[model samples]
Target: MTALIEIHNLSFSYTGAAPHDVFSQVSFSVAPGGVFCLLGPNGTGKSTLLKCVSNVLQGWHGAIRLDGRDISRMKPADVAMGIGYVPQNQNSAFPFLVRDIVVMGRAPHLAVFASPSTRDREIARAAMETVGILSLADRPCTTLSGGEWQLALIARALSQEPQVMILDEPTSHLDLGNQVRILRVVKSLAGTGMGIIMATHVPDHAFIVATEVAIMNRGGLSRKGAPETVITESNMRDAYGIDVKVLHVAGGVERKACFPSL
Candidate 1:
């Protein structure tokens, strides 16, 4: 499979702290229909990496190519056309209707001062349906529950018709059921050939949805490969400082789970 995004020799450092890089020599590639998970403990530059990939941060050195074009050379509008980003938290500052918020995703396709077209509305509607939030379209975004609001945010991004999606701890603060729901949606999206790059604290989430995994530690990815290999007890211990048991649970379809050895 051809990679939709290719990252190489990436490094980030704050000013006056050249000796203290946040993450150095970070590298990975994400192919269409593949989920490349970045899993690590907090403050390991997981979110920072996503920001750099999504072009939200600057002052980094390396190469990030989207569809054979260097991201640095792509215009912001061009980047928006191909990538969608979901942050860990949702903004409730506005009382905008769900459909309105979702429609905003069409901004990438519109000219300056232009509004969403009828076709854009149709696309937004489909996105809402895809995320299973069509019924909530009329509701105010601020009135949604945590899970529902996150669903709306996803729908908003989907409305952009992006080829790749970047999510940062998207399941944070949700109940287990909601987290599972979000992960399922993520898996479903990648099945349609949208490359997914997600930063997560949950190894189990990687096992659930990732086709490939990278374990990030201070300033680098320590291990990366298939979930079964990269999400091992040893790698988990190395990245998280916890001794864990990676168990294969017997079911109709075999499933993998991790538990801390206490």
Candidate 2:
């Protein structure tokens, strides 16, 4: 399969009295129709990497190519047209209708001073239906539950008609059932030829949904491979600094920390 997106020798740093580099020499590629997960402990720069790929953050050193074209040279609107981003949280400062929020995804393709056409509305409605939130179209976004709001946010992203979707901690603040629902939706989308990249701290989620896993530690990619190859006990320890025993469960593999009797 061809690579839908590629990052070569990527590095990012923050300047201060004492400069700190968040990530260095990171390189990876996502094939079309692939589900890739970035896993690590907190403060590992996983979200930072996602932001860079989505063109939310600039001034990075290295090459990012989307569909064989250099992304760094592309305009932000063009990048937004090709890539959709779902942040960790949803904060609505003002009251906006659910449909209105989702419609914002079409901004990349809209002409200045023009209203959304029937086709645009149809697309946004289809996206809302995909996430099972069509009934809430006219409701205020602030009234949604955390899980519902997250799904709506994803629907908004889908409305952009992007080929690649990047999500940051998508399962956070959700119940177990909702988490499974969201993961299933994401997995299904990837199966349909959308390149999906998700950053998650939960190993179980990565095990269930990701075909490829990239373990990040201290702002660098430590391991990248199939889930079974990269989700080993040693890699878990290196990425999370914890000793764990991986067991095969009824549904999937499970990771449990090992502790000596005191």
Highest-scoring model, TM-score? 1
Writing each residue's lDDT as its tens digit, candidate 2 over 1-262 gives 8898988988887551113389988999888789899998898899999998888888788899999999888878788888999998788999899998898889888877987888888999999999889999999988989898989999999999888999999999899999998998898889879999999878878878887999988768999998878888888877767777665665443533223122
lDDT of 1 at 234: 85
Clashing pairs in 2: none
Residue 181 of model 1 has an lDDT of: 91
Per-candidate clashes, comma-separated: 0, 0
Task: Tell me how candidate 1 scores on lDDT.
Answer: 0.90
TM-scores for all candidates: the values are 0.96, 0.93
**Candidate 1 TM-score, true structure as reference:** 0.96
Residue 150, model 1, lDDT: 86
* Residue 126 Cα positional deviation in candidate 1, in Å, after optimal superposition: 0.6
